[model samples]
Target: MSNIELNDKKIQILEVAEKLFSEKGFDGTSIRDISKMAKINIAMVSYYFGSKERLLEALILYKTSDLKLQIESLLHENLEPLDKVNKLVEIYINRINCNRGIYRILHFELTSKKREENLAAFAELKKGNLKSLETIIREGQSKGIFRTDVVIPLITPTILGTFFHFHMNKPFFQELLHLNTETLYNDYIKNSLTKHIQQTIKALLVYEN
Candidate 1:
């Protein structure tokens, strides 16, 4: 096939794969499903993306690149570090709310065997983002806007928790916390953001020097 033909097919496969993987999840969506939805042959899907797992990696890379660029652009110039931390969460949360499915897929794949081996690229990207957070937190501490005792290495999970739990758990959250389902979506986030961000900022900024 010609290069243009391959490019068109690859784009189509990516589009179909993203929606299917996001909606049906990695385990549920098969190559046949993607091929069928894409109106292409299985070989073509595999040929274009190499494998289902690679297709997903491509999807994640696409989403991450765009999002990271936006974040870097927003934070590139002058801004307070603590405020940047809050903006990080706010921007992330806003992005997730807009496209929860992609976040869900990324959350799901981060644990998969196929994804684990292919995760070195993602790890680098993640490390870069974490470094940005660390820098902001450190700066906030210096400014006395946050506590001085917070350790950057120790807080990655908490930041990830804020992102993951919101998408992964909702029914049990409502049942256990006895909160309404509909309202919990946004209201819970508002509450969590206010409390978590403030406490996280303080905990990471507490006196260490």
Candidate 2:
């Protein structure tokens, strides 16, 4: 379902579902749990979403709606291609950091056999984001800033995979970096990690010859 189609009641249910699903895995979270937490009746949720799985699908669409706007805005900016790419990295890092819980839910659900049907929900979103990256890369290539032989498919994963690896191993990283406080961890993500991902992508895109 599109974000425009969601009313307050539907958004409330999605918000509650995202929260519960993040705290508890998709399989662990039920429609009743969402309705109870949302202070609504089960029938209302069922009427809106039909089932727990559909609710999850709706939540994915709702949460990512802003991403399209962000990418589109960035694309419209007149910055140099490489600079735009760096800003894109910042956007992605900030997005994942801000919505870590929802991403975690997606990760868990993707692995579970019960959530097979929901795998495609992210495909269109990923495709859109990938198209944005391709736009920037094409601009860079056209201007001789980036190499023509760039492996387009590897670019998104390189950025996202690096961030995901760090997120999944936050405890190890916290110990390794000695980030004892929540503030320190967040600061590291916002500063150190964001720059690192930007630089990594920069290296991947910059022309070698």
Candidate 3:
């Protein structure tokens, strides 16, 4: 086949595989299922991606970078620390609130054992984001704008983890907490989550710096 045709087919295969895997979980989806869903031969899946493991890697690579670029753009700006944090949270909620496919795929990939190269790539991405966050927290503390005791490493995960769990696990929370999918969770994401994170930081306030 032509190079363009080959590339398109590869993208098609990846897109289909990503959606199926996100919706069905890793074990629940198969190469044949991907092939059938893509309307291509099973051989094509193996040909383009080599193996199911590699396919999963490609999916992880695709999904993991969605928020990374956004974070990078925010960090490059001179916005205040508080605005930066809010923008990050807003982007986080906006992504999950709109394209749930990304949230689902990313959530699944977080549980998988990806290849070393993939892991390293993610570690670098994470390091950049963490550095941005740490920069903001440290700056805020220095400016007497935030509590000096607000630990980045400690609450960083809690803030992000809470955002991920609540935004990505909305369906389960609905089934578990009887949350109103249409209105209630949206409210919580905007008001409750944002406020909780802000208040958590407030606890470390030094008043006099």
Give the top-scoring candidate (lDDT).
2
lDDT of 3 at 176: 72
TM-score of 1: 0.74
Better of 1 and 2 by lDDT: 2
Candidate 3 lDDT (Cα, whole model)? 0.68
Task: Report model 2's TM-score to 2 decimal places.
Answer: 0.92
Task: For residue 173, give model 2's deviation from the true position in Å.
Answer: 1.3
Check candidate 3 and list the clashing pairs: none
Q: Best to worst by TM-score, what's the order?
A: 2, 1, 3
Question: Which candidate has the top score in TM-score?
Answer: 2
Q: Residue by residue across 21-51, what tens digits does model 3's lDDT show?
A: 7788766789999999999999878878777
**Poorly placed runs, candidate 1 (over 4 Å):** 1-11, 112-114, 144-148, 172-195, 206-209
lDDT by residue (1-209, candidate 2, tens digit) is 55438788888888888888888878788888889999999999998888777777777777876877898899999999999999988888888788887877775556556564564667778888889989999999999999988999898778878988998898999999999899999999999998999989888889666
- For all predicted structures, in order, the TM-scores are 0.74, 0.92, 0.72
User: What is residue 151's positional error in candidate 1, in angstroms?
Assistant: 2.3
Q: What is the C-alpha RMSD of each candidate to the true structure, in Å?
A: 4.4, 1.9, 4.6
Pairs in steric clash, model 1:
147-205, 147-206, 148-205, 148-206, 148-207, 149-206, 150-204
State the C-alpha lDDT per candidate: 0.69, 0.84, 0.68
